[model samples]
Target: MMKSFFKVIFLLALTTSTKAQELRFGLQPIQYVSETQGPYVDFFSTLDASTIAFEMDADSIWHARFKVALSFEGKVDVVRFEYTSEDSASSAPLMLQKSTFTFDDTKEIEKRPLEIFLYDEVSNSDWSFSDTLEYVASDFWLSQPVLLDDVEEVPVNYVKRGVSVVPVASLGLPVFENESTLSMYTEGFVASGKYILQYKLTDAYGNIIPGTSGFARCNTGSTPVYNKIDFSSQKSGQYEYSIVMLDSTGQAVAERISPFYWYNDKADEAAWNGPEVSVTRAVFENGWGQWSQVNEYLRMIAPVATMSERRIMTNLKDSEDTARIASFIVNFWTDKNAMDPLGEWKGYLVVVDKVDQEFGSRTVPGYRSQMGRVFLQYGAPSLVEERSFDGRNYPYQVWQYDQLKSSSTPVQQNQVFIFVDQELIGRQYTLIHSSALGEVKDHKWQYHLTRHTNAGPDIDATSTQYSRDNFGERISNSIIIGNQGTWFDRF
Candidate 1:
């Protein structure tokens, strides 16, 4: 029998903050098998620093203390996290505090109620969280991979199986240009065998990023598998990191998956120094079908083609010159390669295939659909906020991006695209507004979103300026960029 573990409700909401009085944090449980302790679960919790109340003491130093309690079955356990201004140079804490509590069961557990409570004694404020602890019994098992900020051999209380680890307070991880590795720690229990640990990092939309997936050989004896993968070539967005344990025959025995965000604003600006290969005109004509196939390819590139190329493609639509169409296709991809240093046409071909699968309709191809066109042109958004079930607004989605990776125009950062499903079926998400330079722009976007619902006298009802946690509450009120008129002002 084979087993798989997945939690559908496991989602990370970033780019938003909570109200001043409220509290926010991330809680995760990683289960592992120990030789002496049998099976145990390590529950890791990280507190958001924004809501922590820091008071000045008699020495004029700021200090904060949070009382945390865990209740399971009929027993209760507790831990505390304390911080001081001397820890960092900022008024507020520079980093979030994380604490770990272990539950030793020594046996398999199903769905067991686990309640956690956090209280700020100074502010007289309290927050609570509840989650389930699950562990499957198997001869060969792998622990849940914990996303960590750092892992070292230094001895500390946070050290569980072996190495000391600092977990990211939040699930999202921003990848910088200088960052080289995405670190994670896991454990495996084996009866006996040679195995290979395979890892793959893919985007949130389930598309595998090129060169981000690989595996290494391992002989099993001890647990606590500390591994790192090359994160130097990734772009900005939310991604899923998955690991699979393979037997000697290359068959997968166990697997684990975790979600995190990656950011690299300057990844496209890298230098491309390599041997130049000459392009042959006949190369495109021979592999491609005649004029009919060439016409479809021309239409497919409309989302990324330049204005001049688009005008020329329009005139060349009727022409039966197969060689000329192939030339245009080559020139189109070549020009894009010049602008985009790290991206490739082959990788984009994979995205085109994905567009057909996700955005295409029976009547029209996905590339032609407004949602598909935006996706193809701008690439995937960093965070896609979908409020489909809310009765106050149409089933709309907000796709926020750090920057558009591939576009005809030179767009600025923090652009947004809004799409709404009017019919509420058939996946027909029409594009109503965008913050990009050349895409569709509707000044009355809020009016359209709230046409069915009553907006009353309160103007703030239609505004989408809520904190990062509440960013998906309503429509945007202010213009994209005020005086500049268009979002893209400079190259």
Candidate 2:
């Protein structure tokens, strides 16, 4: 009886293993949703087609059922196939027959979703399976190729180290899906060398995201080799792209790594529509006299100056009496505090110096930057929240002041400034909307910041129903101005 039981157990195990092998089907490489730009004429043409493999056990049923389905823009189409006589051997693997299905266009430019469903009704217990992809319409917008080193405020150039290309500074630019045509111009410094350029998307923690990597090969010719990347399939976010050039023996000779911001339609539109910013060229280009330059520097400080101080600086700019201007500069601080006038002046100088070093960009002075201007004016914020990068929203930083100098006299509480990296690039964050008076105010700031969340109304709406935790709020005309006492307390 024991021997019979053991044999029966072995047979049962064998039967289970055989049943598992009776039917199995896997999809080949399907066209990824992120890679597509416009509507596909033939969806299969974009896919890397491969045969679906099927294996059957010897005792498995010869008759089986198969099904395929496609869905797009809320529409669905399904096809069913039944196998009667066995066209494939039971003991070997067989390639299933392929099917072509047509998808009708909705005449709209939006996310077109596709889904495929397959069922094995006989050997595999008639189990159901599904896969999906999202495509866009012809109205998909593409990004114009932007040289990373040539951004408005942050321009960078590649430095040649031996045979490798290195960015002079860390560079960033907004890349869109429509700009599928990626071309890299490499000066043919190395003849007959093969270069492989690739990009990979990584989260803030630096772990690579799956299915977001691709590579292309370019052979160096007599002239500069313009290598066009096969495709761009990256989704919206920050990513690190690297290129490596190999010698004839396949040894890496040169390489470079650059950071990039990938943005979608709404984010791109917001970036393009940022406030027009112009920094005075006189700061960097003009060769003014020593006192004239000092007067110009004082004018830049007007953003943070008291009303009286601002008037003095403005008058000094037009003053021809150099001695009077010089005396006013000294008395400007001495009158405020007779005890430590020099100390106050020196302290303010230190702040200016720090702001220049920290906030100064290629095109704008430190005090001219959005953050720099606010820092100089309001001192440091009481509550600072920074969301540098997120999968959903554009990079933004929130500055909250429990008490602030809203104007020359009135003090206000619960004041805020929402600086958005509307350009999606790292530099050039602008004051999109603010709560402080005498400052640029836009009620739709919350909508642009949380566009990815879809929690608010359209961009044109003055107010959103949903408020984000850090940066969304409406300012009222009435403000609590109980204290000029605590105003300078934190300052």
Candidate 3:
């Protein structure tokens, strides 16, 4: 039995140029083991929008016609999609497409030849990028590490899951010319499991570079990999970055190693280790002001702190050694900005203050609330659409992010979070649904939103958003009256 899941995404500002006879593309294949459905492979592919020639139709609407075919073992499956760009095709950079293949054998490891072909209808150009699915399954699954290069020095500011990848086309990898840091992304799967994740950078001869190795405790289906190393001292050479996952018993269960070539033509680019400042007790004393403030600030950064940092914070919660505390603080932010510890600290402080002022209440500081923690940890949403009580169902708000990035995960674009005010009194918006990976997700979120009104999980979809009689303002378009419910700006 085989199944295919197809998804398409378009971008407005993805502008690029290409010749008429070229169909620039790339493919990234990821494998996973589903608890119920067994094993599956997902193929994520992208095309340079410049390679796509969009034509204005009779109605003045611009459309791009294209088809992708996947073949294996003499069997072929083609997916045809009509992509719409309106008037932004010229500036659009990449068009993302996805397809999934499931295995009926449920084998832990399956190796098969897979061929991908893309045909450009506008230019009559076609290209083939063939790959194989060599999957190995264990108690957990670790995907190939994808290296994303910002050749233009412009951060895309948005990411679709499994979409950031290097191409096999002529664009080629950057010369390490503009980027100060490189981002490597990967995915993992476990049925509610935890593992120790480690990343390392090694030279051509396999020597581990100093300060290029770190580990963190990751827990999730797609566990977030967050590690940083010093890239300043790196000389021009071939390097391999490895991702190792260890079980609870400290045994290496699975590892993905990828080799890459790094030629830093612009090694002279200005390095930013932050403004240098002497580390001393005065640095701690005057920076945080009072001893009480030092302790308070230490307690405040728990949401973004790593497991090791959290442990240190646990031990430092009591000690009165302002100098040691200051040193710890400096070392912590130095990971973010070597010398400018105050830079990261001060910026985070601003976010904390905003969270407190907005989400805090008379009894509970905003940071402790669900909405406030999300704001602090995710750095606020792109928009918050608040829905007040309609006298039938609970009041809920939808928090949407144009792009959401965590200290552990890469940027996730078009992410959404939904919170419900169960009691409908205290304004404590509890998180009920989120599309962000590793976050809580409830498929029956609509049922929960109206469950207080006698709706059950098995209720039909139509009734979940409306009254029992199926009449009243649809949940999709409910407007808050008097224009005074949720008054906070998106900031």
Candidate 4:
């Protein structure tokens, strides 16, 4: 039995000013392996080799006698040609018929005169045609997210037209250039099982936009399944797409999600640039406080700035004068840090970068995140308590500040901020409650932490007071809810 396992062929279409042609011969990655098995004792001599073949088809006829044997040492020796033209109307003798072109090495043949020329001696005697060819190796490789060993798989029901689907393998669809399509390869499954392909798109804020979920049944008869996800009709914006897998019995087995960003280059260019800024000589020389631009630094610091300072920034925007913005930054920092103005501003930039790395979101940078705002306003939290998502509730976090400080001015102490990932995906946590005044607050903070529980307020009381029994600590059950009651609320 002749068995072949690995091969990938990509059909590329090229269009010129006058005509369109299809390219079918150049294989992607341009590598093929052919093998032949031998008896158990003949392992050393069992044939395992590779070769390249090309065929020319025109006028509804096919011909294929060209073979280029690839050496085991990764080089080409010669190209054997054995093609004959069947056009009887042309009495032209094939010029390079039955020819063998020897090469010193692969590099020499790829760069030299390998173009074949034939003459139609009967029809056109001296009307000569020329052909030239040159070859160069490609350095392209496919891109995908790095899968770590400890990465957890999230299984999602494949949704299509509000219906559920099951599949064997899933690929998280990614944003593609408008002219391109998303391509992926999947393998490792018990043969003869059925599968399906599903995709869902969500906007920057995690809202499932209407008319986005779609699916298609996949033909899994071949090994190493190849797929293409098209996006010719999707709009330009940031989105999240997921792929879910189901078995032959229509049960979800695995899933993966990835981000997609499509830039809208055709939008109003001027509107995108926004307002420009102007700074003083001292400030400009200090690298405009190390932000990408002076205006960006102004925008980032807005959350932590005082009302009066925010007014100045608002005025600077209306003026559209870079000089005024520059002056405001210098005077603002100088007034805040008269002795070491430059050093103080540079130090703040460090905090901004750290916040961005830790709390940034798809639509908002870290410096603009809810946690980021508090960090810049009150400094680092004195204590941070994190609880991973346990499928009972959303991933929730707690931040406690020993003292609330603004620009080094002490405000309040023993303050706390609570954030919850209500969606359980996307990782963008919302501040649901806090102990600080003027912030969103609710006395029942623990209730929100276990929002998915049926035990309600009493379960919140036991969990908050740490008085729940050993069994209660392990799982959330209806029996625990009835027994625990609200006894701990007295404390």
- For each candidate in turn, the TM-score is 0.52, 0.34, 0.41, 0.35
- lDDT by residue for model 1 over 1-491, one digit each (tens)? 22212221221112222234324344566665556655555555555555567777898877777777878655676867777774432344324444343444443455667787877766667766676655444456676676666534443766766566666665223223245677777777664678778877676446787876777665444356676677766544456778888988888987887766555434422311123333345565454334457777776777775433444666566788766666666656766677652245566667888998998878878876777877887788888888764675678789998877553344457888888887778578887777665565554566566566644664434444321222354345543311112211121
Greater-TM-score candidate between 1 and 3:
1
Provide backbone clash counts, one per model: 6, 3, 7, 6
Q: Model 2: per-residue lDDT, tens digit, 282-390?
A: 4223322255455555555555555334434555677776655555545555555578765776777789778878777788777767788778877788887778666
Least accurate 10 contiguous residues by lDDT in model 2: 2-11
Error of 3 at 283 (Å): 4.3
**Deviation of model 4 at 259, angstroms:** 46
lDDT ranking, best first: 1, 3, 2, 4
Instruction: Give the lowest summed-lDDT range of ten residues in model 4.
Output: 39-48
- In order, the Cα lDDT scores of the candidates are 0.60, 0.44, 0.59, 0.42
lDDT of 1 at 176: 30
- For model 3, residues 274-333, the per-residue Cα lDDT tens digits are 343335655566774455466666656756654335445566768887666665666668
Q: Model 1 residue 76 lDDT?
A: 76
Clashing pairs in 1: 15-468, 16-468, 16-469, 17-468, 17-469, 175-263
**Overall local distance difference test of candidate 1:** 0.60
